[model samples]
Target: MTSYFNDVAVWQPHDLAYFKRLKAYGSRGVVVKSSQGGYGGTPYINSVGKLQVINAKRAGLKVALYHYGTFNSLRYGQADPASEAKLMANTAKAWGLGKDTLMVLDAEDSSLRTKASADAALFFNELKRQGFHSFDIYGPGSWFWAGRLKIGTSYKLGGWPASYGSSSSGVSGAKAWQYTDNWKGLGVDGSLDYGGQYTTKSAEPEQKPEPKLTKQNVDDYYYTYNPKRVIVKRTIYQHKNNQLGSQANRGRKLKPGTAIDIASVHFSSDKVPVPYFKLANGTYITANRWFVNNAYYELSNLKTIKVIKPTYLYRDLHRTKVVKRSGFKSNKWPKGTLFDVKKVIHWQGGFVLKLTNGFYCTAYKKYVKKIK
Candidate 1:
């Protein structure tokens, strides 16, 4: 089963009954905010911080601590890093917290030379040097996405940054989520932890690493995660980049009947990155433009057929309306050009072949035949 931890601050008081209720509701962890700035240029535990831990432990919950982060640059006067670390260390000791108890840095202010990640690295490095283990960083969703904080992999737990009353778009790279405040009438922030991210009654068990898919190992990713694929319409050019300007420089027109795996799809976006699918060989097609101009064949299947003679391509499934029939018949293809047809469907009196490009053509056996 899964477990959860709620990061509580001074604003939230210690209620033993509430703690017991949370335990009854399957919460096994509580992360109390233990420090703030201005305690002799160092931060100390919050007013009810230690007491909250005691109450949570009494109510049978594992307790961790987080601190409101501030750096030397943000301080108006003398900022002593060593003294601040000493004070926090003393508070951590006073509360009997350690690696198993998880210390988190809550950094919202981007005051480190306007570089949140850099400042985070600086502050977290100091904490590490001071012999603190099991660190974490908490901030808004954008803070993690814009990647301002250089939060190395050493930190395990990640808390969601969504505040009260705002909808969370998504949680990217976050193992744990702080989805909302005012959770279920308790007025405490609610969270969801994935895997064994939040601890249970036992120590963390060892885990195996999951394999990643890169260009070098795309075959593995494709074969492992293959889903329903798509068939191309008449024709669409695959571009190196989905952006229009870049497409001009790097567009390679692909024929109909080519299958492409869905890389990603979005109904709308500011930037439509990864609109199409990548080929099994790791080639990619951009879906930014063309809607894209691809369509599916019968059962989304593609089969190759050789043109033994010239054939007139039709504009629609009824082959009588030949493409450019009156004006030089530009759509006609010579014998050498092979057509990848989904099937030669029986249409009208004469048969019309269903092309992968979502068009139809005459399927006279003498003129064309399916190849093995």
Candidate 2:
């Protein structure tokens, strides 16, 4: 099971450190895809080239060069067929990579479904015909051979990281797998790369013992004690702290549908910088960013509530109100009486809930209802 790290044009500044660490973790090979510069010249191969040089300087390192068939159509038109071949040829020559280095064609854009497939097939076949033994193919699981083009044995697979558990089963004759499109440990500015036999290990264990918490639990609290719980769903991205706004704190993005066990919740007068939860395995991570009501629920019960209302703030002190209503509200409750939470707003010491109907109210801890 050979693993290939395939991020060429999307390389972030900190990818160098990530590559080094990946190698330390037992990766056998690294492949970089080249991207065009901000000013738009031949995609700058300098960073990737330098990394290759550095890896070559080290012992027992394998590095490959890859180029995307086409960048975002919005930014760069479908990669010119002639230009694509030239990019591969030039990068190989510049990096002094011989037949030992792998050359990959990552083709996953829906816009170039047919054209890109043909181009990639031609490019890789040409490389193989010229005696390039390590040539490969890559793309998101969905887009690979979308046009039904026959992928010759000369090419291998470079799948997106998120597609691992789901689509990896369908991949055949793939010499390498590009498991993740992003790695947050590299920071928002950096991306983690994985390849070689090291990537075959499961990065993290699945969350177990699902929580039975439901909308009834939330509504029971509102009616019995007037407090409500908010539920937020977070997806993991490759860059852990990439979307975080404040420099003072860091967080992790959850895999699109990965379940997490929420340990605890906290509220503050100021915005809470989401904390990054390190996984037992150094590879995967979790972040506690979503805040509901005033309490933070652990990943255990958190997964039960899919729809959460935002926290709303109210200035009027006289009227006692119930802010945001959860979607899991009791189906037995009257329609107008149930208020949905839309957004979360900070107030006093903790946070306030914004009801779906546009009302604001405060939830006291005593009002929390826990229903099995």
Task: For candidate 1, write residues 184-213 as lDDT tens digits.
Answer: 667787776653445454233223243443
**Model 1 per-residue lDDT at 178:** 77
Q: Where is model 2 more than 4 Å wrong at Cα?
A: 1-10, 13-18, 35-48, 56-59, 71-79, 110-115, 125-131, 145-150, 153-169, 182-184, 187-372
Question: How many clashes in candidate 2?
Answer: 39
Name model 1 segments beyond 4 Å from true. Answer: 38-44, 72-83, 110-113, 150-159, 163-169, 201-372
In TM-score terms, candidate 1 sits at 0.48
Candidate 2 least-lDDT 10 residues: 298-307
Cα lDDT for residue 112, candidate 1: 38
